[model samples]
Target: MTFNITTKNLDTFKSAFIAALLAYIFVYGFELTHFTLSIDEEPLDNFLQTLSAGRWGHALLRHYVLPEPYAPFFTTALSIIILSLSAATSSIYIGLNKLQSISFVIMLAALPQLAYQLEFSNQADTVSLSFLLSVVALFMIEKMSVIRASAFIMLTVVSLSVYQSIFLYAATLTCIRITTDAIKGQIIFRQALKKIFVFSLLITLSLIINSFLAKWTALYFDVTISNYLTSMIGWGKRDVYEVLKSVLIFMRDYLTFKSAYGINAFPFVLLSLITIIILSIKRKRGAPLIILMGFATLLSGFLLNFAIGSGMPPRAMTQIPLVFAGLFAAALVISRVRYIGLIISIIFLCIGSAASNKLFYSDFMAREADQNLSNQIITTIYNNIPNFDEKVTPVFFYGSYSPLNSWKIPSADVFGSSFFDWDGGNNRRMYMYLSTANLIKLKEPNEIQVKNSIVAAKDMPSWPNRNSIKIFDGVVVVKLSDKLSPYNR
Candidate 1:
C-alpha cells in the first residue's frame, strides 16, 4: 500500500482522542472518590523540592528511587522521564489525526498501569511510563523516517534522566534482540550474531548517554552492596517458557473483566492480542512488534520485581497487559474485525468484571471510613505525651527493620509505601515488613517510656510489643503494640 497522508493523519487524531478520554477519566475518578493514590505524593514532592533547592541530582540521589549513597543510582530515572512525557504528549496528541494521535494517546494511558497507580500515586507514574512508551513509539517512527534523528535523540535523552531507565533500556535491547534473532536460521548464524553484536553496542551506547545525563547514579550504590541483595539471592533464575505461561494466565484472569486487577488483568489483553498475533504471523509478520511489546510488558515486571520487589508484585505485574495491548492495537484494527466479534468480546468481559466489582467498591469506601476512625484513635493517644515533636516519624512493627540508615524516630515505615521500591511483588510483604520492622526499630528506645506513660494514665491497654495495629474492616493502622487490649474491644 502506498502512503496516504490524509487518511493516516485522521487515524492519529482518533487514537490520541481516545487516550485523553481514558487518562482524564481515570485521574479524576480517583480524585473525586477521594481514594488514596496507590503511591505516596511525598516522593515527587520531595524531588521537586530538591529541584527547587538548586540541587538537580541530589533529589533523585536521595529520594527518587532510594536515597542513594544507599540504593543503586537513578535506575528509576527512565520511569520518571516517561511519565512526564506521557502527560505532556497527551496534549500534543489531541491535534494529531485520529489514528496516529489516538494510537499514541491510548497507548500512553494503557502502558505503565498509570490509572491504577493514580489511585495511589496520582499522575507521577503516568508521567514516567508516558516517556518510556514515547521511546518505543519514536523508534518505530525512526524506521520509516530516519530524518526523525533529532526527535529520537531528544526522546532518548529525556528517557535516561528519569525512572523508567531500566525497562526502557531493557525493552529496547529486547526489541533489537528479537529482530536480529528471528532471522538466525534464514541468515547465516554468524551474520545474525554479528548484527546482534552491533545492536548490543548500540544498547550500551544508549545506557552510556543515560549515565552521562544522570551521572550513572545507579552506580553509586552497587546492587551487590545493597540489602535487596539478600532478596535477590532468594529469588531464583528466570525461564522464558514459564514467563510466557504466566503471561497467558495473567491475561485471561484480570484484564477482561471491567474491575479486574493485577493477577486478574491478563484475559482481555491476551484474547485481543491473540487475534492480532495471528494476523501478524500470517500476513504482516509483525513478529518483531509482538516480541517487543511482550518484552516491554513482561520485562518491565521482571526487572522491577527483582530489583525492587519480593516477587510477583501485582502492581508491577499489571503493567504488562496495558503496554502490550496498546502496541498490539497499533499494529491491527480491532474495530475492523469481520463484523464486531472482537470488540464485542472485549466489551462484554469488561462489563462482566465491572459488575463483580460493585460490592468491592462499597467495601473500599468503608475502608476509607475505618481509616478515618483509626486516625482519630491514634491522635487521641498522642495527646497523653507531655512532649511532642512537630515532625512526623514512621513506625514499623514486629522487629523487622529497614535496609537503609534512617534518622532514628518514634515511627519509621522502613518498607512501607513511601520507601517501598518493590517493582511488583506481594503487597502484604511491603506493608507487613515495613510496619513490623519500624516498630521493632522504635521499641528499642521508646518501649519503656511509652509503656510507663500509658500505664500511669490508666487509659491505654498493655502492649505486646512496642507496636500494634489499629484495625478497621478494610485498613490496618500500625501503632503501639497491644496484645491485652485490642483496639476494637
Candidate 2:
C-alpha cells in the first residue's frame, strides 16, 4: 500500500524526523546509556506510593516496571516521542516554516540542564511536561469542537496534576495566542475576556480536582494533604524580595552561561531577544503584544524556578528554555528578512548545542569520578575497621576531591553524598554506599541528628578528634578532608 502525502502529513513527517535526530544527538552527546539512580531514587517506595495513590500511570511504569540503570532510556525515549508530536502540532498550529521548526528543535536539543534531567535527575517531570506540551499543541492546532475542547481539558488536568510546571507552558501559549490576536487587531475585548476566563476556569478546575484526589489519597494513607499543599505553595510564606533575587540569579546563570564549565548562553539569549523585538516591530501588527510576550516569558521562568523552592541548580528552569526557544522560532517566522533571522538563529543554535554537549559531558564525568572515590573509601573502611560488618557504618566526611580533576568539592555538597542522599536507605546517605558496594547488612543510624556534634568510638584512617569530627558508638569516622586519598592512605 502506498501512503498519500499531504502538506500536513509532510509537515508531521519532517517534524518527527527533526525531533528524533535531535534526541539522538542529545542521547549520544550526554552518554545517556550510562545512567544510574541518584540518591533519591527509591524504586519500591515510589511504585507503592504512586500505584496505591493513583497518580500518573507513566511515572508508575517508570518506577515499577522498568529496570534500574536503563529505565531512564525508556522514559527518555518516550519523552522524545512526545516531543516529536508536540513539535509537529506546534509547527502546524503556528504556521511555522520548516527552517523555523528546525531552529526550534535545535534550540530545544541544546538546553544543558535538560540533559541533566534526562540523564541524572528524576524524570517524573519529563513525562508530565511532555504530556502537557502535546496537549497544548493539540489544543492550538485542532478545531475547537466541543469534543476536542473537552479532550484538551481532560488531558490538561492530568498533566497539571503530575507537575504544576505545566502551568508555565499553558500561560506561555495563551500569552502568545492572545498577543498575536491583539497585534492583528482581531481580538475583541469580549473574546479576550472569554479566553482569559476559560483558561483560568480550566486551571482552577484542575487544581480542585487534584486537591480532592490528593485528599482522598492522604486519607487512605492516614496522612494530611495540608503539608503537600503547603510544600507546593511555598516552603513557608513567599518572600517577595527572595523570589526576585532567585529569578535574577536564574537569569544571570542562563544568560551568562555560567556552569562548572565556563561556556555560557548569553550571546544566544541576547540575539534571540533582539530578533524577536525586531520582527515584532516589523510586523507592525503584534508590536504591543511583544511587551506582553516579554513579561510572560519572564514570568514563566520565575514561576518555574520558584516552584522548586531552594535549589536553582539550573535544572529547575525547564519551561523557561522551551519558552525562549518558542520565542526564537516565532521571531524567525515573522521577521521581514526570514533568511537573515534563520542565519542568526542557526549560529545561536550551533553555539548552544556545543555548549550543551560539553557541559553535560563534564558533569557526567565528574559524577563518575565521585562515585569511584566513594566506592574506594567504602571498600577501605569495610576491610580495615573491626566489627565493620557488624555495626552501622556512619561516615563523617569534611571535604571532597574529584579523582578526575583533583578539583576540591565544597564541604557542604559533594558527589559522594549521593551514596546516601539518593539511595533508598533513609535520608542519611551512607546506607546507599554500603548497599551498592555489596557490603554487610548493618542497619542505618537510627537517631536523626539535626545539629552538629556526635560521639563515635570507631575511627578509620587518620581521623582527628576535632569538634567538626563528631563520633558516635558503633560508628566509623571517615574524614573527607585533604590529605585523604585511597592510594595515599
Candidate whose TM-score is highest: 2
Model 1 Cα RMSD, Å? 11.2
Q: Report the Cα lDDT for residue 353, model 1.
A: 34
Please, what is the whole-model Cα lDDT of each candidate in the order they appear? 0.37, 0.50
lDDT of 2 by residue, 137-243 (tens): 34632345667666666666566555545555666656555544454455655665577677667666666775576556556656433343345443455687776
The digit string of per-residue lDDT tens for model 1 on 380-410 reads 4354332323233322222211222232212
List candidate 1 stretches off by more than 4 Å: 1-11, 22-28, 32-39, 42-45, 48-112, 120-126, 129-133, 136-154, 169-201, 211-263, 277-312, 317-319, 327-371, 374-479, 482-489
Worst 10 residues of 2 by lDDT: 449-458
lDDT of 2: 0.50
Whole-model lDDT, model 1: 0.37
Candidate 2 clash pair list: 39-422, 39-423, 40-422, 257-264, 420-429, 454-471, 455-471, 455-472, 456-471, 456-472
